[model samples]
Target: MGGVDVVYNPYDRAVNDDPYPVYARMRTEAPLYHNADLGFWALSRHADVSAALTDSALLSSDHGPLLDPGASGPHARTFLSFVAMDPPEHTRMRAAISRAFTPRRVAALEPMIRQIARDHIEPAVERGTFDFARDIAAKVPLDVISELMGVPPAERAGVRRRSDALLRYDPAGQMSDEGVKGILSLGDYYRSIVVERRAAPRDDLVSALVADGELTEDDLVAFLFLLIGAGAETTTHLLCGAWYWAWRNPVQRAAAFGGAIGAWVEESLRYDTPAAGVARRLTRDTEWYGTTVPKDARVWILIASANRDETVFPDPDVYDLGRDTGKAISFGAGRHYCLGGPLARLEGRVVLEELTACVAPDYDIDRSLIRRTVHGNVRGMVSLPTTVKPA
Candidate 1:
């Protein structure tokens, strides 16, 4: 395959839908491609991506890992949480909340999570035709995070809207002034909630953090903002990705629905990862694939590309649920590996399992009409429409 340019805009709708072909070209010709347009280095091979993710000394996630040259606002600095922090600080902050995000804790919420999924889907199951993204996928993460944070159920919709707005970035350029303001507004709102949680003391994560004094009011709010920002949209994409993947592969979908759906979900994650790329700043000059990346140069590790590397994954283009690739980097790796991974997986499995059980027998998904989100960082369907047989 001929090499393609790696300097494409991430927000471009065309790139979001079919970046694989381009990524394939990059892996073949420019495994360590540098994008002058974006002013960052891109690593497309599996080894390079895995190395960059684990090399905290050489590559740091701090100071805006996603190559946003415009995120240098006061609010951005204030809202920074352990996600951007490295080493001892990251360990400390992560340890504080580690117990709450364990597999056991996430599993314990299975009943409640399943209940939420059913509540969201039951209404749509009867409708026969509905927007799966808006009506179903979008609600699961928002509801889960809101409930965990003790945000009033009634207020979740507003919080979701605010979070969506805050995370929005222009693919064309840096975030707009208004976008920065919206993010700050979200921080302020969460700060106030944290203060309230401190006063009242509840069983929620926010309350626990405040009561333990491990986090101040500001820290608690920022942490919640981080959780909501990191945890919600990624899970949203995972569901949408699953829906799109299943719609395209009915036989596999049938096999998945048969019994081993968890494996299917993991496969979907590897095939179409929600977090397509992660950025890290080069803390020291490094040689990647024989190319010298200068110190302070930003590197974008294309997780989607690495996941599909033909060398690492046989028949990388094809979706195989049974392929035991031994822990894909879809949830990431090393110290910054996602803490909410178990929660996201459980949520995906429950929702997909329930949806497949309830609707797969009755509905024919319209793959052609499925609309994908126009964002590079997240690969997902914006609207998945399907026709259902009457009950």
Candidate 2:
């Protein structure tokens, strides 16, 4: 840790609130710093982070660091979802879901997705004052995903609550005991849904998985769990990221509303990615940036930091909507690139378009009152209060 002061605990609240400065320091001072307390090596530079993510032979995601150490054993076995699986198995599971997530399939949902966003935003816009995060951004994705997954509209609230609970992690890197229990319960609920779908298949993801005989019940549950958890949560953060940027830069907001919102969304993804970092374990001994990582060592790829690497992006701290560096690691890279990237982008574009079209340009957004989740893994606003004029 020559050039930087290494902090072992990644879950510390202060660190989660604003990790860029620390990441910048690390990238400048110690690009490959090993933390003894956390027992993981951190890769903060753009080059190193990119390399670590793509180097499957060296940095493997098969069985790496658990986000919540306390829930290791049970969570390890239960949470062996596709995200944790290596190739061959990962390829198979990914292939099973690929048909549904293809660009055409996702693009087709644009109209319906826009309608969903309008449905939620129209009412809130009429009200003129509401928590943007809760009322607008958060609600849209859950409804769209529910429709996509064929989780009947009535059961959506339960599904959202359970998914939120399961993903809840504190600043101390610990999950609520109740959250773990809720995850198991969710798994059971999805299992029953799978059984029912088996009896009579439908047109949703659940039915599709059930129709694929190659996937087991556990596999189906794990896949769905990943969908609900990552799918909903990441989009939620993108929404928050949009608002955060708009609030900070009113000029950028105006430009965004003037038909260039897509760039704003992309910049937001780079500036404040939902998943700040991803974990992997070294499968074989490897040397990077003059440091040798022993086999079996855990590593954290600092995605948010890489996005802001000074060597990569000019004036990295500033939020420039027009800057098209085309190198942000927000969706990651290589084999493990986010499969739902198209879906997430569509959701973000729809929400921003609908909101800006109906709401006034200078809508009142309270930046100071905004609240963010304390968890390190998922960075998103918990609440965003704002006022907008009705159409």
Candidate 3:
């Protein structure tokens, strides 16, 4: 497993389907394997990834965190978000975002999140069968995030479609033309909303951003994209991925329904991570693994691998809802930890609660119809069909 077996080819569909084996081999056989083909270094071990995440001066996020071989950091349009930025610019924007997207604000979204999940799911239960990814899992996050942004109900569906398109890539692993178009469309839509919020502020995230008055127009738009791209898609994947794990393990599913839904979410974040990895660029020449990393080298911190490190979790691949996953770097570490993590967990809890307690307690996942998404980053199903047993 030394040579090609350890190469991290993100574009390969097979790797996306089941990257665990590849990551497992990489963790032991080649922890510091550098893919000259990809022209980037990788950090696979849990300790190294954890350390590099906080080592900002050595491993920088300024050049963005998602990429392919020979691709630029972040995307041309999404370069404004704090996730793609390094400090002190990252620090300043983070403070402004913290001021605007506060804990109190996200907590207020709980009731609304519950209501949104109920509104979308309760009706679908009557159908007996539907795609969970589309009908429920995807809608809950889209509407909740949109509602937080003060987007009207009439516009939520369009927003979801556009955002989904923006994050999708072609089967050949290239970013699609539609994705670029989607980005452009969102930019226009958010700019219009920003203008409206400026003249007459509302009690939504966008209005809050406008009120902050610190972020530039481009930065505001970038932040909005980050919210949807980072939050929506990954969250949708989490719900579906959690379902994939729990459905396969009815015991854990029952446990989650009983009282430990939060634990299930945490395990899902660890067992089947939503965002697979995050990238950081070297600020200057640095020494790692007893070797020198040249300045401007791209270091791919494989969070998925770190979370599954055998040294940390005895049976790394097993989906244990009761597993203690405090040390997992699913939401990242150090200065760039996920700000919306609390909200994400809250949403996950409510979603599982509604599905099991209210909507489909005896539902069966149509595993044959489940389809994993194709993309360079993030891991999730694009379609998950489910049906309730006949009463």
lDDT of 3: 0.81
List residue ranges in candidate 3 displaced over 4 A: 1-5, 69-71, 74-80, 170-178, 359-361, 389-391
What's the lDDT for candidate 2? 0.80
Put the candidates in TM-score order, highest first.
Answer: 2, 3, 1
lDDT tens readout by residue for model 2, 1-391:
4455656456676777777878887887788878776567888889988988888777776762245444332244355476777788778877887867888878889998998998998888888899988987788888888888788878988888888765665534566777777777888888988888999898887887677677888888887787787788889889988877877888888788888888988999998888788778777888877777898777878888899998889998988898875999898887788899889999999999888788777778787788878664677887988987754
- Candidate 1, overall lDDT? 0.77
Candidate ranking under lDDT, highest first, comes to: 3, 2, 1
Candidate 1 residue-wise lDDT at 259: 70
The C-alpha RMSD in Å for every predicted model, in order, reads 2.4, 2.0, 2.3
Q: What's the TM for model 3?
A: 0.93
Best of the two (2, 3) by lDDT = 3
RMSD of 3: 2.3
TM-score of every model? 0.93, 0.94, 0.93
